[model samples]
Target: MERSHVPVLPAEIVEFLKPDTTNAGPVVDCTLGEGGHSALLLEHAPDSRLIGVDADATMIERARYFLGPRASQVEFVCAWYDDFWLSYTGARPHRVLFDLGISTFHLAGSGRGFTFREDEPLDMRLSDSVMSAAELLSGISQEDLADIIYVFGEERYSRRIAAAIVRARSSGSLRTTGDLVETVASAVPAAYRRGRISPATRTFQALRIAVNAELERLRMALPRALAALSPDRGRMAVITFHSLEDRLVKWAFRAAAGDEAAVGRSAVTAKHSTASKFAPKLIDTVAMPEGERITVLTRRPVVPSHEEVAGNPASRSAKLRVVEKTRIEESW
Candidate 1:
């Protein structure tokens, strides 16, 4: 909780999305990590109703404290964003934001082994009900694990990393974040170990994605989010951290904006591979949502300025994409 999460593009988000100024809004923050983004959004449109959702209870509590008196305007929901949206039957949202991917809270504070630098339990479940990373590594096949690391993490050394994990499992050494890091370190080449990015980074990311079902949930949640928007003026902004997430968001937005079908790579398939060796049919075949379309507000993704990134290096890879809902017949 001591490590505060800086919302990636604070000014850009507020400037792009037009939240209801009539005090009759219910702007939903789908991934309310540390409440930084929601706090600023509420401050910008003080009268708007706020519904903050986060899978981690720790994050929820911290966000609640951070929001302080603004808590009165918020309806805090401790649930996955997709799960929350699936059953939600409240007033349509005036504006919605999805700050996708893990935040600093996960790496530094969540004791969930989201960080390879940490020596915590390999329990990377964003929600409580799912299997932890430790459990996943224990039971999964090396080939399937390699595929996940390749397709999800885009790691070139996926086969090596997965094989190392399998070997570590036999010795019961894949129990914690540090153990996994050591295993990854031992598997990859020495040069790769000393690369700019840590060797374990992609493996950890892939494991978290698998354990939390992040991409699957994102696909399910996008159309629902678009549907939840107020048709007249509802806008949704998504900030993705990596290539995989950005690709998914781009395809979904294109579909909503009336691309014939935003068909793209199956979540499990690698571009070089014919098909996924493991996992179900995870192809994205998105289309217009319920006879409605959207106007993609961002022609190109907005990136953090050099000044911002210099101040906060973690913000360097962030990309913000925004969309506004419109009737099918309406032309921008």
Candidate 2:
């Protein structure tokens, strides 16, 4: 399978990123799943340097091959975006792109069990993490497992599915993607199995999220990336395929902006409080100045165009949200 994973929302990303056109600094492709977005940015901004990061070693290798000569312009790292953000203390980057969720290649053919259609091992770790889907199923309590499916995957049949998984595991290890699919199928009503969507889809999604710690990692990474962004000189773009990931990105951006407001008020108070010796104490601060923060570019997230969705079914669910860091004085 030629890794049918086409980059989602390429034109929208390029338009918002505006790479190097304004003499912006370096750009970071935080997800860099096959370097599709990176290659486009490099083509648009010949002078800009690229930092590409992915947790999967296989993705980095594939990116190198696919990007070829353009790959030379990028500094590739095989690490999660969270760790990359912490380790990267260099000059603030001009832009960052985060495409969350599994790439088409992984879902279609990686044999990592991203899809229930494949009979691969139940291993959904994006990185070489300690936990695999099988291990998670084997270890977690049924209640916790059901909660994960309910909260993360939003599956209606979470209780039944989780119970089925526990029952199956008790007999023999539920060790493969086939095992999980069958377990979920058995739990749902026969009518559900023949519904418009697969009965097992949400269960697989929940397990993948659990195995990869995707949401938690994104929550941790977004702040650090914002902190490293140049005031008014940087932008971050995130493409989320589902509601769970989109919710995290939306709230994180709002929270960061809110913190920025609080910090400014504190700054003014500190100056006046000096005489009283109160010191306008900073309780806890992860606040970046308003100028050095994120400004949501899309009041409403940008979705794939009708034509694009028609052409690539995988892109149908994609929603792109962009935030640009503005100078503290600039009203976002």
Candidate 3:
């Protein structure tokens, strides 16, 4: 099958970003998977430049090809967002977009086991620098593995699944995605296995998150992204697929926006909330600012429209949150 990616929330992104028409600054795409979103953004605002960043080298090449000569206006960087943010010395971005969902290329062709339907190797690393999911599972302790699954995947049967994996590893049977999927299926209850969603979904998601250190990377990149935004004129949008990611974006933006009402309503302290039970450790990973620097454009995350969901089932879980940098006061 041909690999293709449908940029989620296209109309909303263009509508909200309203990319600077005068080429005032670049619109940075932190997760330039297939470059669908960036291409659309450029097309909408022809004068806008793009700074597209992706960790996968294949994605970089593909995005370059996809962008054609328009790629000249885009700076395609092959590095993880956090690293790219650290070394970046570019014009302040008027718009920044981060679509955290995995790309269709990885799901369909890269064969890194993003999809459980395929019996590929259990290597979910987004880049070659990190340890593959297979290596991670085979090396970690059962307790730690269970914690990772429970925290990142929010899988209720994480303990059972971890125990099964340990046993399978001892027998040298847990090497491929098929093995992991079977192990998870055997660990969960019959009802859970028969549920609408695959029993392996959570486990696969957890493995992918751990292998990519996704949460950690996001935590590191958010602050830098905020700093890069052009005050008063900058807009940033983030699309998260999972609860852990959504919560991080929600609170981080809330704190930055200084939305006292939202912060007051948080179950735990905005600075440090371990209330999730699932990803308790992640609360500390993201440092929420105590003061205002931006405006939360969306009170709640924007979900995919019914029409969009019907067209692309994979986009059903997408939640988009936007924020705009607050105007700076000149120090006379």
Candidate 4:
């Protein structure tokens, strides 16, 4: 079957990010899945350059093919976003975009065990990451595995599933995607399996996250990304597809914005209360002010429009939050 690729919230993302004004700067597409959003951004902002990053090498290649001549203007990096930050030593970008979680193509086509429907190898490494789902399940203790599934996937029957997996592995190694699926199916009651969603979904999601270290990587990468932003000019946008990711982004943005606000207040109070010759500068001249270093542009995350959702059902779960690095002086 031919796989279809669709960009989520194209019009809204373009509108939220007025890339047209950034004539000479670069925009980082942090999760450049299929390059659909990158293509639109490039089309809208003809003069702006692009730095596209993706953990999946196949998606990067697809972007290159679809983007064609515009591909020359884009710099594609096949690495996890966290590692990308570690290796990058360049000018701060004007805009950054992070579309978190699996893309439609990855869920539907990639034989990485992202979805339970396909019985492929039980591998779920987005990058050439050290761990695979099968390895993780086999190595971890049953209790620890249950904890991972419960916390990451919010699976209610985590203990049952974990016990089943352990039993299955003891008899014969759980090596394939089908083996894992069947294990999960057997753990849940037959009645529940006939419900709206498959019982295996959460277990699969949990395994995928653990295999790729998704949450851990996001936690480490966010601060580094904030630090890399150019004062006043840099803007970062993140789209999260799951609650765990959404919560992380929400808390990160709130913390940054709160810090910025506090710093600004401190500077104002210092300027009015003290008049000594040795009085420190109201704004930190050495660093971008916290206020300038980051601002939460979206009070609430932007969701796909009704039309967009209708056209692409996979995007129904997406939530976009944006942060801008302003011109004031304080640490991020």
Q: Which structure among the candidates has the greatest lDDT? A: 1
Instruction: Measure candidate 1: CA RMSD.
Output: 2.4
| Stretches of model 4 off by over 4 angstroms after superposition | 1-3, 20-23, 259-291, 329-332
Model 1 segments more than 4 A misplaced: 1-3, 264-274, 277-291, 328-332
lDDT of 1 by residue, 122-154 (tens): 898877899998788878998999999987788
Candidate 2, residues 180-268: lDDT per residue as tens digits? 88989999999999999989999988888778877667767877887787775678888998876776676666656664433322211
Residue 95 alpha-carbon offset, candidate 4, angstroms: 0.9
**Arrange candidates by TM-score, highest first: which order?**
1, 3, 2, 4
Residue pairs of candidate 1 with colliding backbone atoms: none
- Put down candidate 4 lDDT per residue, 311-331, tens digits, no spaces: 888898899998887676545
lDDT of each: 0.83, 0.79, 0.82, 0.77
**Estimated TM-score for each candidate:** 0.93, 0.88, 0.90, 0.86
Count the clashes in each prediction: 0, 3, 0, 5
Which has the better TM-score: candidate 2, or candidate 3? 3
Please provide, for model 3 over 34-85, each residue's C-alpha lDDT reduced to its tens digit, 9 standing for 90 to 100. 8888988888887778899999998988898888877888988889999998
Task: Give the Å error, residue 179, model 1.
Answer: 1.4
RMSD of each: 2.4, 8.5, 3.5, 9.6
Task: Name the regions of candidate 3 deviating beyond 4 angstroms.
Answer: 1-3, 259-292, 329-332
> What's the C-alpha lDDT at position 99 in model 1?
93
Better of 1 and 2 by lDDT: 1
Q: Which model is ahead, 1 or 2, in terms of TM-score?
A: 1
